[model samples]
Target chain A: MAEAGAPIIEAIGLTKTFKVAQKPPGFAASVRHFFKRTYKEIPAVTDVSFTIRPGEMVGFLGANGAGKTTTLKMLTGLLHPTAGRCVVDGREPFARTRDFLSAITLVMGNKQQLLWDLPARDTLRLNAAIYGISDADYKSRVDELSGMLELTDKLDQPVRKLSLGERMKAELLASLLHGPKVLFLDEPTLGLDVNAQVAVRAFLRRYNERTGATILMTSHYMADITALCSRVLVIHEGKLVHDGELAALLRRFGTRRELRVELSHAVDDAKLRTLGEVLSHEGNVARLAVEPAALVAVVGRALAELPVVDLTVHDPPIEEVVGRVIGKSQRALPNVVGAEQGA
Target chain B: MNAALRKMGGLLSVYYAYMTAYRAELILWALANSLPFILMGAWYQAAAGGAFGFTPVDVTRYFLAVFVIRQLTVVWVIWEFDQDVQRGRLSQYLLQPVDPVWRYLAAHLSERVARLPFSALIIALFFLIFPPARFVPHASDVLLAITFATLAFALRFVMQYTLALFALWTERASSLESLMFILYLVLSGAIAPLEVFPPELRELVMWTPFPYFIWVPARLLIGGADVDLMRATVVCVSWIGSLLVVNRVVWRLGLKRHSSMGA
Candidate 1:
């Protein structure tokens, strides 16, 4: 067993490349390709490394196809990395020994392990057996987890009959039945309603607090991250771009503040450009992007120079900040934003 | 050991519930394997002419036994395994401590349990429709036939599941099973008993695993089958063991190649 406070999840220079078949268009090309198909090496994840200590909830931030899921698959032993090493709970994940499997769980939002035709309880029973949870332990764990997830009343219903939120909650319960010390959740709140998302997030927080289990989650919903995770990892183009506190990510890409201005009279587009980069300009109102350090100067200049009715300065949304971090090139990222050594 | 039993029991009971949940489908699947009953007519005419060294009664009884054997030994792991791999469902099973094959194995076993009553009902209806085909076998013969039929199911499952493992490389691995199943139909006595084959051909077929699948068990249940029980047992066990070794090797390599797509 790993010592308390030790890193429960570690990835060192992990890399994964997939050989994808490329189909050419056209009749001649189709026949020729069928006979001798070509393949391209697509790098899904590259030279990524990070360490997550026990009980830390780390949000993995990335755009679609940004290797967040690929990294999770490697950590869960669902896919073997082409290069590098990963150890979860003191054992190689790909080895998938009984001890290692018992210590970790992977939950995917779009994919389910539940038996759709049967009650969620049936699958939970099967998982308990597979994980070697005794009958008494199984009952207690189910009671505890279902209560925590607010799904105690829905266990006996067929999974297909449950609401999407209820089904997702049950999936969480099934994955947590074994009391895994580490969780790799890929968009657990995907497709959930606002209230459902909140419920899942709260359940995860409570789960972490109660079990001290390390959680690494990826979600398109920024609310999921901001609600539960103190730290975040940002991956861009299969490379680790940023790894630190969530606030640091905002501060890094939070350089640009959105300035919304309302004017009493029409303002020249060219004159608005002088204050800052004009994002959008209308008859009298305009929006500009300005650096935080120059916010006061820009605001004062805008108010003095233009017939401003009202002006407001706001920080960019967390989604756009995280998006820029993921969408930017590795070269564009600040030098300090890389995998934390000795994390 | 007790924990293992509990796990097995859990898997079996859960899958049994899954199978029984679709009662109409269960009956339909049982009836789907009644190809032997359809083929009985053609063989019965040939036997009536004394061309196959048997009476008409022999043909009817043989095919009846074949129907029961087919019901017991039917397997579709290849389809389920192929879809699981292609859709990334197998990754969920791989995350657990137990081998994924046991889940498929349990499903097959549970389906068999769910299917038994229907098969028995169909058999009883068949005997009622054609009383001439009815015969009481010795207790020993029934026991041996059940044993061999059970082994036949194991052999068939291992073979198709081994083929299914290729889905890791190529998503449509069921095509391989389809190709092999063609050979099974032709040589496994599903179409006709081994008694109709020429002496040399019969000898060759006996050496293969095909006859042990249907002919050996079917003939044993109906009597008058000239089979070496000792040789049949050895061959069945050997094929199962050999295929199992190949299955494991393929499974390991398949896991390495698994992309876990679509999840």
Candidate 2:
């Protein structure tokens, strides 16, 4: 058993390299390729390492082909790492013991495990059996999780007939039926609408608070990370770039604060630029990128000197901060970046 | 019940539901194995001319038995496993505590259960079309046929699943099954009985696993005097055991190569 406060998930210098077939275009090249195929070794994840203590909800941030999914796959024992090692819940993940598997679950938003033609209840039951949950416990768990997810009435509908959000909720129910202590969620809300995304995010937060389960999740939607995770690990181009508090990440890359101003009358764009860098300007509304140190002064000056109806100062968007981090990492490690992008 | 048994039961019931969801498709899939009837027509005419050892009546009974065996022993694990590997669906099963093989096995079993009623209906229809094709076998022969037919399904499934493991390296592993299927067609007596083959060739083919898949079980149903039941049992068991070992080895190596594509 894993000890309390120990790192339940650990990746030490972990890496994965894929031997991708090189298929050149053109009919002539295709025929030659068919006769004698060649393969090039492309590294997907490079010497990345991180440790998450039990109950930590650490957001995994990355861009497309940035190895977030590959790292999760290796951690879940679905793929063997080409180098280094990973241990989840006190066991080598690649060994895949029943205990190890029972302790962890991986949910990919683009993939599904539910039976498309059958009701979601059937899959929940199957998962219960597979996880060794007794009949009574299974019933109670389903009732509780469904109620929390607001999916109690939808469990009986065929998965193919359900809406995408409902299907995602059902997939979540199936993945969580085992009460796994560790969750690796890759884009849990990839294509969900605002309401669905909020619902999922809220459910995850409540589940985490109640169960104290560790989570390592990746999402293209920045709101998911900002809402659920206080700490994050940022990977760019198959390498770990940042691992610390979410606030620290913002402070590091968020060099400018955003100030939105509503003027009583139209102001000259040049006048707005004198206050701060004018990010955008309309008839009577302007957005400025003010340095964090000068945010209060800029807001006061805008309120006192300009014909301002209202003004608000806010931190830079999490998306911009994260994008800047990725951009910086790409520039810093151009030579070490892997050849292949892993989504 | 224990957790393992409960898991198997759950998987079987769900897959049974899945298979029976489209009732017409089930019947169509069951009827798709009608090649034996087509070959029976050609062989039945030849037998009527006294070209083979058996009379025309014997040819009809043989092909009918072959049809039954085909229904019981048909395995499509290769295609399903290939798709799972290529589409990354296999990762779902791999992440679970149970081995993915058990899931596939349960699906195949459930599909057979869903397909049997339709198969029985088709057999009855065939009997009505040709009354001479029906026969009343001894109870012992009936039981033995069931036993050997089951063994044939097991052997065929394991063989094809072994081939399917190659999907870890190549996306088109079913091509291998297609290539091996030609040998299966010729040697399993789907086209004609082994009695039609030369004695030396028949002797050699008996050592292979293909005959047990169709010929041995079909011949057992007819109580053919040529079948050495003890030898057939030993060979079938031996092949299953050997193939299981090979399956595990290939599966281990395949896992090392698996990239969990399409995720």
Candidate 3:
């Protein structure tokens, strides 16, 4: 009936529905609706349940309005589920008790906790005081995080003056100053340059390795999930469609690989079809699709029969595979997974 | 409690720094409070030969006290509250371990602290114009009035903040605030002293929280009256306790709506 060590974050039959008014498009209709409005129940998250063991890094995946944000907000205690319940670290999230709050941190890429007009150090100090961190501990944590983020020189500048990357780093420092045991990140890498995204991804990986904090992150950026999370929970139209290791999901749907070969001489398209389905042929160069099991055989034949000068293989575009995965459920239709082509 | 105070200290320091940094906004706020000076000049001119039960000097003294008390007690917490709720800036505060109320309180208090120098400058200007003016009463009464003014500030801040929570339910809460503001301006002795009203009207106004905010403090400085002090103390304490209770109830209800309905 019970496990020896329970999950740190647990949810059961969680459902949330919002009551929205139906207002018609004319002045008279608006007036009529104002007096006696019709209502519709829009289910955001429906009967979703999952458990996250301690020290696990899990990515939450969905298209926009696919209940990714709603679920995250509920877990962070920003919203209450209309039904069922969730517990983070043995405490009900909606209760939002001080101990519970101090033990977890939520970082939103669009929203910031730093005071806009004040120096980053002041806001960090305020957080330190609110969390009741000791002076020595605050100093050490600030120094350590600032050092890791390369933000020591930027701490004294007003937040508005800092670059976007610098500001996000400062935000990370502020959120981590208390050393929370759990992290909830919503698009923590949104709208950043490639270098900044890589840096942030590296920092998050290093932080997880060092602290072993349980993290449940939702990111539109596929690279973010692929880089940091080995496990993923995919939600589509208020329902949990996939819950497993990321590699397994990729392997199942990412079976199609592209094989390209540059021959020493020209070859006809019909001959190239022997190796696999020829996608495109340009003179001596050809691109073909092959299944996983036949990849080696196809490559060997191409090398032996054709004047193959150079060859390369690639997994099917990740975006295409992910779209197919979400597309499978959506063909039954109603909740299309959020624009699942790519982040 | 120790942790709360420590946290408040940090907030106050940041707001204080903000106050010092944004001197232009502070100056603009000071200029806005100069309405009392205009009212003072008009009333003084009208009483040029001592009319409406007061001499010109008395008119100057009353308005000067009004100016200083206005500086001390006026708060913009309602505006901030409306903006926070409307724009969802409150989300940032909700995620944190600390209650966000103290941040607003510290912000308003620091504004008053920053306005102290401007109030002193206004006092100097008042003295420069009416050279034969003594604006304060007996030493004990002055101190008591200052204490009463502090409580009045707290009362007004909390009351306005409590009313502003209606923004969570309705988009037009500021209309209610503006209606209340007009009543306060007319009855709280911001525009004219309550003594000018008929005796019956004055009695009715005294029962309201308006007089404790401006008239009591203003009247105390002009004349040290024990009865006004007693009434102010009773009114200030009762309104504060009552508003605090209402604030707690409203805060809980508002948070429920916010969590369920989304900010």
Which residue segments of model 3 deviate by more than 4 Å?
Answer: A1-4, A254-322, A330-343, B133-137, B224-227
Rank by DockQ, highest first.
3, 1, 2
Docking class of 3: medium
DockQ of each: 0.48, 0.46, 0.58
**Docking quality band of candidate 1, CAPRI definitions:** acceptable
lDDT of 1 by residue, A115-157 (tens): 9999999999889888889889999999999999989889999
**Per-residue lDDT of model 2, residues A75-183, tens digit only:** 9888888889998999998888999999999999999999999999999988887888998999999999999999999999999999889999999999998899999
Query: What is candidate 3's CA lDDT for residue A237?
Result: 79
Error of 3 at B24 (Å): 0.6
For candidate 1, lDDT tens digit of each residue in B135-207?
9999989999999999999999998899999988887798998788887988899998877788899888787
Ranking by lDDT: 2, 1, 3
lDDT, candidate 1, equals: 0.87
* Residue A341 lDDT in candidate 1: 27
| Model 1 superposed RMSD (Cα) | 4.6
Task: Score candidate 3 by lDDT.
Answer: 0.83
lDDT of 2: 0.88
